[model samples]
Target: MAPVAGRPRPGDPLDPDAAISVRGLVKRYGDFVAVDGLDLDIRRGEIFALLGPNGAGKTTTVEICEGYRSRDAGEVRVLGEDPADGARAWKARLGIVLQSGSGDSQLTVRELVTAQASYYADPRDVDEVLALVGLTEKAGLRGRTLSGGQRRRLDVALGIVGRPTLLFLDEPTTGFDPEARRQFWSLIRSLRDLGTTMLLTTHYLDEAEALADRVGVIARGKLVEVAVPSALGGRETAPATVTWTEDGARRTEATATPTAFVADLATRFDGEIPDLAVARPTLEDVYLQMIGDDR
Candidate 1:
């Protein structure tokens, strides 16, 4: 089959050479188009985060890549093979953890993990898998019996038990508390250290910044931009918002060189800049601005 326009074809460039690649991916729902000419490349062992508003086409794009849905038009390769025609072998090479994981809610965590491991030819040690996700203590508990964070961890354990080279995490920490979120982040880092490529989607901007080596933002059914989280939308170049209190009055300014401005303000007041805080636009700030502008 011919590749979609402005996208990589199945035989071009050859992706077993690349971990994941998508070209001119198009998905539509009746009169509404969900994805428009999307193209992306994800290298092995990198955590790539997909970001967007509620209906910005993030989930639809992910579903297509996962082979859960076929693209209306496009050629996609995951783990170096076309996901649309992906086989059992290709499927086993990848792990997927959805927002709602396969909970044999009645099945113990150990049972679920063991069963998943059985599906693969060379799976990770069940015990090692539990340890990797920090769920050893709860191994005996049924999936449904675990707390939200614990269930999420079990979900992750199941994903890795098969020793997949690539893993997909969809809003893995949606209901987690602060500490739980941190723990999950550590687990993700550990997975990356072990050479697992990850594709992540999250509503939490901080989560994206913390876990993703790079992020792609989608707006209005199209990918508007992609960059390292810290540098998205030239956030690194955007001036810092400097705020201070003088004569009991608060003042602020956007400056390219905050340190210089701080020093000058310090001299003007002949003392420390009162209540001074130099804040750069955060990934969240930039993301919100971009999405708002697109709308």
Candidate 2:
């Protein structure tokens, strides 16, 4: 069995009206604590990103919120009800896209989505959902026949067929190529425009920067920081890494303001700085550093 992550942090007070509230949340496996007194506030109609290194409790936390796993202790309210005790009707208001397990593969895309809609009181039109996911062209294709990216899109289509108020996207772009990932991002934005509150867990920091309004970073199972992407892990304040070429030798420096440094370098060289480039930390760069994976 995978070891339970035991390092969830106890943070400051959270605001009321949070769509998902977790206070003092704890989950255990015999002698180990998977989650420890974690507190988080996911707001309504906003994209909230949950991130951590592998085995850092990201998946477990999402499962607990999805009502698929129970917590040993904590106060969790998802969409005004405790998910542990939520009814089917309450669940219909949520959309979840997991990595696998929609294998009615012999079924057509339309059939698969339509079948899921039956569980909801009122579902969006199957064709409309397909169109929303950019899969309308392949609606008649059997699930097994679709390409990997297309199949992933169908998984998402099924997730949103009910027009859920809150959506949980678990690594939606994991297997997607760069182009497919960009296309998927557009579909997510469309859902967001409809006022769907989203909880997104993604390994791809670029994906988070593109989608999340705020991001939380967890390290060794503990949430160390929660902030906007530009400022996550002090990314904005971390010194800029400036790169240039002088006498055909590449050189660099870490400084507070690369622009000012570049200006001075330009005067020293009496011209344009050779191969000049000012670099700030990409979301991935800062994320790797935070996770202790910097090399």
Q: Whole-model Cα lDDT per candidate?
A: 0.85, 0.83
- 229-274 per-residue lDDT for model 1 (tens digits): 8889899889999998877889989999999988888888765667
Q: What TM-score does candidate 1 get on C-alpha atoms?
A: 0.93
The per-prediction tally of clashing pairs is 1, 0
In terms of lDDT, the poorest run of 10 residues in model 1 is 1-10
TM-score of each: 0.93, 0.91
Writing each residue's lDDT as its tens digit, candidate 2 over 69-165 gives 9999877889888889979988999999875646757999999999999999889998899888899899899999998889889999989999899
Where does the lowest 10-residue lDDT sum fall in candidate 2? 1-10
lDDT of 2 at 121: 89
Where does model 1 exceed 4 Å of error? 1-16
